[model samples]
Target chain A: MKRNPIGVLLALIAALALLASACGSDDGADSADEVDSGDTAESTSAESSASAGPLRVGIVAPSASNDLAFTQSIVDAVNAVAGDRELDIAVTDGTFIVEDAAAAIRGYAADGVDLVIAHGSQYGGPLQEIAPDFPDTAFAWGTAVDTFGLPNVAAYTVRADQGGYVNGTLAAQLSESGVLGVVGPIEVGDAKLYVDGFVAGAKAQDPNVTVNVNYIESFSDVALASEAATAHIQNGADVLTGTAQMVVGATGVAGPAGALWFGTQSNQTPLGPDFVVASQVYHWEVVLSEMMAEIDAGTFGGEVYTLTLENGGLVIEFNDGAGADSSVIDGAQATIDGIIDGSITTSDG
Target chain B: MWSDFFTTSVIVATLASAVRFATPFLLAALGEAVGQRSGVLNLGVEGVMLCGAFTAYYVRLNPSGWGWAGGMATAILAALAVGLCMGLLYAWMTLVMHAEQGISGIGIFLFGLGATDLLFQKQVGVPLPISGLRPIRIPLLGDIPHVGDILFNHNVLVYLAYVLVPVITLMVNRTTFGLNIRAVGETPEAADTLGVNVNLIRLGAILIGNALAALAGAALVMNTNIFQQNLTAGQGFIAVALVYFGAWRPGGVMAGALLFGLVSSTVLQLKTLGIVSGAASALTAMAPALLTIVVLVIVSRRIGQPSALTRPFDRNA
Candidate 1:
């Protein structure tokens, strides 16, 4: 009876993995926990500028922290706000299920964190049910303006259309084919706002430019998104934009096709530096900082915060490397200024 | 308006997308056709695809600083390894444990969904892009106009998928193993009487089915040049349908896959040209599923299903 060499090799590798874990220190184990991210793993990192006085925070999101879409927007904002401050951050991401998010939110509250951001609109129902149970713990949820009449809950909403207009203005001028396309997830919610605003802005810039919009009616159907982008490209659309996470698939198609892409929810420059013209980045730090100040002043909630360009909650992140002409950049800034000063209005549906 | 919508460029683009869309379905369904012919109703094809897709993408992400060939080889091997492991587990559950096939299959799907998503978040942490297998144009043939662009300009996986149709057809219809498979599927008792190893044949079929399902995932991830949770996004379940509607015949499965791709791409083209809009567009999204159901219902009645599908084999009984 001959023992297989491959089996022997597998057993040896398993033994080594166990040995490595056994040899690691408590701090190493703690750091490993931070990287062990997901729905179940509450990545609690103990490091802070100050050991005892750092602001304690926890995040419960519906998707991965690095989704480069909705969740990434809040996570990046929180990181920016916590900069140079002794802040302790823990993330329990990929809680797409409502029940899972509710549990994580309660868990963060039970752990007595100073701030717990429940980062999904779907989680709104659960937070409404859970917030009363832990009144002292500050909790926030978004894409909605209602704070559930709860004193301790903070509600944040984004004027994605604000940045959508800026993106639209630039795309209309930049498109060589006089055509633009938008692949929206659904015909409602924040995605609708962005798409509608984009079409409006494109029309405002050039009335003759054909702006096509396709609401595929799904948030995660990547294949359909790809097909929609391809369809738009075939129809002479040189500019493309889509909302929701599934646009990851559309970006892949658009990049190879040399189509200019305008992004929203988060900065998507990293997806394709050469083609992603700009992103309507949500800077939640504007609201989060104000919330922190209110918390320090012994005020917990009772306010609905809207992320507006006027308040610096939304920013049009232009990729200088993508090389838009100075006139286009200047035109974009002028549009932003007009919107901020009430000279321009994003027609809301 | 009609003339604008029926342009040559638009038709060519739609056909090309149909080919790309059909590649994964064709791969998974062909393997599924083989297994179904042997009477194994393994509905865990989608789950196995996720494991394969994730493994292939993760391996290719870093590339181990290897050259193009080395990186591609490594990624493909990793995907195959994951597929083989998933197949063995599924085979054990249905064969050794004699678990209810449909329920166990669903269990596999759910596990793949949760596990792959969790593993991705834990391991990758971010959606980092990878340049997967690139398209290799077929020299002089690729220089031909519309036909060549639509047919000869796809990646190697697309070529492999089309090539395997006849190979699978022959294996299922021409060989001694094929005879044994048909006997077991139709009448296991008679196959046993004839000294056929029913379980071994079934196991071999299951392995081939799952490995091909995995390859379908790899093809998808490679073509997309990216990975996401549930990246296959119901394509696996659709692949399983392709097998059933295709009547356990490789050629039929290929036709079913192509039909689905064509319907989907054509509707997209219509929507883009503004021929479909408002309520019509919403309804158009359901066109592919409706067509698939219609075809499956009509085709299945005409060709019929396997005699012993989803039936567990026990020689003593």
Candidate 2:
């Protein structure tokens, strides 16, 4: 009976090992991809400063970083900055619950991690609430609007509209129906601007073309996005675009169903090879690398930094760069170059 | 007012909302059915559901790019394993150690919630954007006029929930294992004396029940196409109340679920129509739980649960 108990314990441990093995593939793939990013990794190390004891930092997000289209860019930027430094960078999943975010922030703060990059806008409120208690710690949230002015805090934002305008032009030119769809995230001020730019750009390309818009009221709900996309599909909209964090759900529906899609934030072409015509890509690596350089130089301070088209903060990723077809890239780049050179205007004004 | 409320969009929205609301409840209620039938009242359904949803989302999105099927299969499998382990642990605590079932179940719920959130923090490192399960419209039935469009045009889990209702009903009525489960709940000592292994049966039921609860979590995340922290909210507890309204029968549980789904859909549609104020809309969202409470109070006279629920059985007795 005692031997049986030992056997049962071993079986339980074995089962758990099998379960962990099953779970590791996704994470392991991330590491493998990092290895493939050899040049980028080397560049990161070369950039690290010797003066700073490779600042140990932790980042928390409200969701997992798998949507290569938007969230992955931010993650890549952070990881690049960390890998270059001799820093112990810890990243905890925020999972988007208020309580969980609070707990994770407090845990990291307790561990004396020099900086906690609360990346999601949702994390701003929680970090603000927790920040006062942990006075020694510094926080750098992603969105500008959420960061309250404090000695220990900084916020960074990008002019997403700059890229949105260029992609909107591509959507207009490529659409067979001359009707484009813009799926915004919850009607927030920033999302509204992105949608507004897309609409203005589409109409700028062809005054006769109509742009229909919908907002899902949250950044991460892909199912609702799909539902909204379905309605637009039913309404004869041929080119779909969204400002939400997860465009895959909308693009996933639009791609197989024969409607072309323009994506936002990160590169999303892999989600639907044929359907994802192009995306307004946000490269987090450059921004993080720039920021970390300042931080290592001992000149970093609490302030808001907003990047725009002029600084190469945002770029229109033609399907070509994403291993997409040549015909698509050439046509899209015509609009993209026009926007860059000041020949095309995507604004309503 | 009428145009906004009765438009084709509103009708489609309402049907979509019903499917969205029905999925988690159906999954949790099915789990509760198994737990209750084994004389163990597991109230930890909510915790198990949350953990499953979080873990499932993480499994789906890790970049080695497990395709859609692989992603979904991982979630289901992860949920099942977690459910099984939690169930076994709960059984050992409540059944073997003879702890209070209600308290132990609540502990399990709390543990599941915190543990899952922590594990997610360590593993996922950011919020995961798992693709929601796509709706697979059935062949001819999916093309059928009005009903087919409304009912069949939903993700796979919603259909699975619908099928489980009758399947479970039939299982409870027809199968020998089901008979033993029912017998164990009613009078464990008598069943034990009659040569049934009450411990084994109860443990089996708990594991099965937890699995169903995990399924509820998976269904919500997969069908909704996203996993939010505290995603299940109070759906698990509502599922427990539904068991009473359902009189512990699968048919009754499904009817109760349908009513809850309908009420939720109506409220959401009302919000979209702008008929309800923002404050009122918030209140309207609570309609399902309030209705569940009202149903329990009204239906208590007609329904009686097993006499020995929550009491651990001893063969020596």
Judged by DockQ, which candidate is best? 1
lDDT of 2: 0.69
Report the lDDT tens digits of candidate 1 across residue range B1-317. Answer: 55766788888888988888899999999888878887888777898898889888888888865566447877878788888888887788777666667766766676676667767766786676777777788998888898887888889999999999999888878999988888888887789889999888988888888889889989888887778887888999999999878888899899999999999888888777778877888899899999999988898788867787888898876
lDDT (CA) per prediction: 0.81, 0.69
Best by lDDT: 1
What's the CA error at residue A75 for candidate 2, in Å? 2.2
Q: Please, what is the TM-score per model? A: 0.86, 0.72
lDDT of 2 by residue, B1-317 (tens): 65766767567657656665677787789879877987999988887887777767767766256565466677778877887888888788767766677867776676666666446544654443455577788889988776677888877778888898888887777988888889999998889889999888888889888888888888767754555445565778888988888899888888888788778667545544446643554576567678888889999988778877998887664
lDDT of 1 by residue, A1-349 (tens): 9976435543443454344322221122232246334222332233333435667678887666677898788877877766634456777765666897788788888888888888877888889998999889888878778898999998888888888888888899999999999988767667878988898888899999999888776777777887788789878899999998888878877887789899999999988888888999889889988888888787788888889999989988888877777779877989999999999997763
Query: Could you tell me which residue pairs clash in candidate 1?
Result: none
Residues A1-349 of candidate 2 have per-residue lDDT tens digits of: 2455434543554454345433322222333243325564465456676665557666676554555544566666666655555545555543456676677777788888777777766677777788777777777777665457676677878767667777777777778888777766655444665777787777777899877676545566554565556556655688888875655456656765678878777777766656677777776656666666666655333767665565677777656533444665676666666666878765542
Q: In angstroms, give how far residue A190 of model 1 lies from its true place.
A: 1.9
How far in Å is the alpha carbon of B188 misplaced in model 2? 4.5
**Model 1 residue B225 distance off true place after TM-score fit, in angstroms:** 1.2
Candidate 1: where is the Cα deviation over 4 Å? A1-57, A84-88, A106-116, A132-134, B1-4, B67-69, B135-146, B294-304
DockQ of predicted candidate 2? 0.12
